[model samples]
Target: MALKNVIGIDHAVVMVKDLDKAAENYKRLGFTVSPRGTHSAHMGSGNYTIMFDPDYMELLGVLQPTEHNAPARAYLEKNGEGIERIAFTAVDSAEGAEEIRARGYPPVGPTDFERPVTMPDGTVSAAKFRTFQWPTAEAPGGVRIFACQHKTRETVWIPELMKHANGAKRLKQVLMVAPAPATEAAHLAKMIDRETRNEADGAVVVPSGGDRADFVFLTKDQLGKRYPGVSLAGLPERGGAGLVIVADVVAAEKALGAAGVKSAGGVVVPPADGNGTMLAFVKG
Candidate 1:
């Protein structure tokens, strides 16, 4: 079977302990909120707000749990609240899920959804999506890709809160840091059959479409030295807790400085150790 056509980034999920506080932080940075909704009712324990931009960002936090339904709670217990998944848009949702499953990756179904979004034209547009999940217990790069097809292409809504004034054209790359870079990179490479390069910082970049996703392995020793106070002892070995969003380097740096957001040589870094937020604008 042919590989699924990756359209682009569908959305990036950030897991937080308190959705309200997280939303406030993001709002301070400038992100317009989308409508609120629950995930696959079957998943049983979470709610989210979809923030629109040229690309989407999802703020996911667990809600009160029902007896016997505790995955979200378990996740919070383990990861201590951070980014859980990064979704990509595939060309054919069903085929894509199947292709991944056929290759030995745990692939979830093509779950469908119809949601209403307010368009820039002052009209409401209903959008549909077919989502799939890739289950990787020990690899860290991107977790899943959800492909979507809208009823009316004429009314597309990209959230204004996500747009940066620095001319950050698009999501150029995603950086994932883990513990076993080589092993995780190998598994990801085998799964996607893509070329990956080992970097000096024990990181690997797997090229996909026009964008590249980088996975970096951080050992306990490394974490201890770099982040003295943080604890990530028994967290899930896969998935990204942090993300590095890319933009146009020069313009982004200038824009960030003008906005009073501090930067480290043009790169914005968050304060967490194993998990955090970062943004960079390079040549692309």
Candidate 2:
């Protein structure tokens, strides 16, 4: 049984050393990056959001060392910037935490935090959120998992931010490279109380709720096979490899080309060109 309040993928958190530079890179890739927002003092982190319809992407950087952000800091030091975690949309984080406990996964928090959002009219407002995280060991294939409750969706998902220059729309799938794709997919299914299906190309698919993006797990060799001729030099050995976006391939290609960031065969973007996260643009 899937956790009742847990809906689907909310976003992917990309850890970057230089937040401003990362945002610029994403903009060059045709994303409409949001203005910087600083999290609550206790969290000691800042971020820029790349909004999509319901789903999005976050570029996170540590502003200062705090107990609450120790793990994130450690991850950056060890991983050298990459997709560090994935978030699920939760109806109620407190209830979600209870469900997680019932399912035997010890959750970290139902903690609340807020970030200020500056409206187009130059007024400041706040976007609040409540979140809970699964234990580190429970993370499948080294990618952490968490649940988020958006208390102020209006403030966060502003209409203007939803449009991308590359015509990117919503997140379609998250790709992970695991030693044992089936095992990892099975584990993820169990954690979320969902089911897994197999793909023809030896990848395991773990579907998310509603219209949200699914998670795809496969081996590095399989990934290379799937995107023939695409470089995989900086991809992690056993973690998040990239993301697939529902977008206009032509527009995406044009944007990337204009920025001098070559996309392999006009679809696959290697990790090196994607700020440590590979990107695949597909027709919606």
Candidate lDDT scores, in order, read: 0.52, 0.89
Off by over 4 Å in 1: 7-9, 35-54, 64-70, 120-124, 136-156, 159-162, 165-169, 212-241, 248-264, 271-276, 280-283
lDDT value for candidate 1? 0.52
Candidate 2, 1-284: lDDT as tens digits: 77898999999999889999999999888899999999999999999999999799999999888998888888788777788999999999999999989988888999999999998788999999999999977878788999999999998899999999898899999999998999999988998888999999889999978889999999999988887767888877888888988888888888877433344344767788777788888887
Model 2 stretches with alpha carbons more than 4 Å out: 258-266
RMSD (CA, Å), candidate 1 to true, equals 5.1
TM-score against truth, every candidate = 0.71, 0.96
* Most accurate candidate by lDDT: 2
Q: Write the per-residue lDDT of candidate 1 for residues 210-275, one digit (tens) a residue.
A: 443444444434433433333434334555644445555665555555332334334443424212
Judging by TM-score against the true structure, name the best candidate.
2
